[model samples]
Target chain A: MTGLSFRYGERVALDEVSLSAEAGRFTALLGPNGAGKSTLFSLLTRLLISRQGQIRIAGHDLERQPRAALAALGVVFQDATLDLDLTVAQNLRYFSRLHGLPPRQAEQRAEEELTRLGLWERRNEKVRALNGGHRRRVEIARALLHRPAVLILDEPTVGLDPPTRRLLVDHIHQLCATTGMAVLWATHLIDEVDPISDRVVILHRGRIRAAGDVPVVLAAAHSDSLADAFRHFTPESPPAQEAC
Target chain B: MPWLLALRGIVGREILRFLHQRERFLGALVRPLIWLLVFAAGFRAALGVAIVPPYQTYIPYEVYIVPGLLGMIQLFNGMQSSLSMVYDREMGSMRLLLTSPLPRWWLLVCKLVAGVAVSLLQCWAFLLIATLFGIELPGPGWLTVLPALILNGIMLGALGLVLSSTIRQLENFAGVMNFVVFPLFFCSPALYPLYKMRESSETLYWICEINPFGHGVELIRHALYGQVSWPDLGMVTAVALVLLALAVRGYDPRRGLMKRKGG
Candidate 1:
């Protein structure tokens, strides 16, 4: 999909924003606060409808085939979505079932994914007892249980420590590399957008200020650091909520 | 397939949560038991039962009102579940369920079914206790009450779903209870039959005739007495469908019910 735009009343959240994360690529949606990154994620995931633009997930038009589009995308929401009352295994099993997995396969997949996340030891523990980082791992594992072609994570490492964040980002990149899946990872942290492996799309005031290879975009602005390039392109005091 | 899975997932989540909160189950059972045992006992001498339509011979006040009392428990539990939905929405969990790759209608139906299941369990438990208090129904009344409980549970749960989706925040729920619930209960034929209301106020009797809660209570009364009131059943079913449709419409993302004030 291309040229997707959205507005809240008269104020715009995305102004003719066009970007794509092709298969086997990790696309980082880089923007400062209030730059409409979350709004863009909302459009791509079909959480919020767009009157001005469109989105296509895994070759399926979101508007024309919403269910198929959603089915093709595995999303780990910015906020925690785990059922706090359920065990880790129960949570994954339920999510797998929601994706139409049979009961036996769902349970098997749940165990396999939890084991991969280093959470098999705590599979029977209630989600409420898990620490924040572990809870995030559970959510990530749950998202992947469906095995979608495109994985979208909105601010997945928001509350994690630096080491934990790096681990998650590495894990995501490795998964995309091995599975040849497209990934749209939205975050405000500049360092999280790797200069070598990932593409960068910078959003500023509901518009795409720059979109290309990470180093190329930064070099075009005559900046060496991603953070400096982001500040230069995304205006201060943006008129939107972007604390993703 | 996806819709079925979504239904099962949401219902399973709700059931698991309910099970974990043991106090909530106890609280749901205790509230109605108090009214059935204590309040009915104190008021039995003051209130006289006229031969209601479902009644063949004059019944004691406690026995006559048991069905209504059971309906009240389910009704309140439905609202309580709705209250939790609102709370969950505010806390960001309901969004997960809503955004699943399933039809919103199916997700909602699952919610209604889960609520009805929990309500049915509570109804049976309440019936067993009430039977111990000499408030007994026909031998096959338990069999008949199943359908009645299902109908009433869906109707009440649908109302709760609509209320939860329409309300923006949790703080406004109390006002909803005070404004919407108390009037609905007191103005219905739960406490007194329409014929009894006619002796005091013809206007109220007319009001009771139109209230959906009255139909629900009467449906339960008919079933508990081994009689079928097809009209009451039809009315409750129609209301349930209407309410469920509205709730689905209100929660649609194209016109999200969670609009902010002055937006």
Candidate 2:
């Protein structure tokens, strides 16, 4: 969606935000806290409707053809949404069924996704029993069950440890590279952004602060590192610098 | 086809969740059973149940209040489903459901149907318990009352959806439930006949006459005796449609209360 704008009563939550995530590429939506990343996400996901601007998913206009648009989109929200009482496989199956997959197909897809996540062994285990990282993986697997053309994650690595976060980040990058699925990952952590071959869209207070490839964004900001470029746009505290 | 799968998943999840919470299932029963056993015992002693429309001869208070107790079961279960909706809205699980490709209204109808399905089980269990306690209902009532149970359940569930959407916070839910459940129950002829309420107060009688809950319970009472109350059926169905419409509007992103609160 381009030129999308939204508000909460009198307060403008998003102001003429415009950007497009491309196919077979990772688009990192970089924003600090309260930068309208969530609002933008909500609009993109069609959870909240913006009176201004247009949104399309996989060539389907969201407002005009919501069903087709939504069917083409898969999302992993920032909060934990899996039913804790349900088994890992059960959660996956439920999600596939929601996506309209029949029982046999839902089972097959659930198996494939769980096996890919290396969680097939623990398929019968309740989500409550899994660690944070494993649960996050399950959510990712759930999002990918129907093989949506566009995959978006809102702070998907929020509570996981550094190693787990790194693993998830790498896995998503690999998935994007291998499957040619358009990926948009929103996060405040600067370290999550790859220095090479990744697109970045920086949103500051509901407006697009910067948008482009790693080198383009770096050159545009005239900075040596992404952290510096990020600091130049957003007034967030010093991010955790990469350890040498 | 996708909508069917979505509906099944939704209903299946609701049933699974209800099963997981044994305390909730047991709690749904305790209130009605208490009314049937203890309160009915005292009420039986205090007043007599005149021969009602469904009753050919005078019936015991236990037997007469059975339908009302059944209505109470669905009412609470419906509100309970609403409470969960509020919880889902807060936990962001609601986002998970809304993201599905299926229409949102269909998803909500699935939710209402699922709640009714669970309440049907509770009502059956309550009826069994009542029989075990020596309350005699017509044997055919067990089957005849199913449709009535479903109708009342949907109407009450739709009411809950409207309530849930208007309520912004979980903390306010409990207060609203009590405020709603009590008035709807008491204002209706759940405990006594409208005639009894009329003898007490003309105003309360009019409230009972118009109360959808009253019609629902009366419908159940008539159905239990193998008779159909067309007036009650029409009233319940009309109210159900209105409430469901309101609920759908309440959840719509652009037009409903969701626009103000940001679901």
Best by TM-score: 2
Instruction: Write the residue-wise lDDT of candidate 1 on B1-263 in tens digits.
Output: 66677678767877788888999888878988888788888988988888868889988877877788878888888898899889878776676676667777887898898898888878888888888877867979998988999999999999999999888889999997797778778777777777878899989888888889889999999998788899999999999999999988877778845334110
Show model 1 residue runs off by greater than 4 Å. Answer: A237-244, B258-263
Model 1 C-alpha lDDT per residue in residues A75-121, reported as the tens digit of each score: 88787878788999888877776778888888877788788889999
Scoring only the A-chain of each prediction against the true A-chain gives TM-scores of 0.93, 0.96
Best by DockQ: 2
- Please report how far candidate 1 places residue B54 from its true position, in Å: 1.0
**What tens-digit string does per-residue lDDT give for candidate 2 at B1-263?**
88888888888888888898999999999999999999999889897988879899988898888999999999999899999998888888888988888888998899999999999999999999999999998899999999999999999999999998888888998787568899899888788888989898998789779989999999999999899999999999999999999999888877534453331
What are the clashing pairs of model 1?
none
> What TM-score does each model's chain B reach against the true chain B?
0.94, 0.97
Model 2: CA > 4 A from native: A236-244, B256-263
Looking at every candidate separately, what fraction of the true A–B Cα contacts under 8 Å does it contain?
Answer: 0.47, 0.66
What DockQ class does candidate 2 belong to? medium
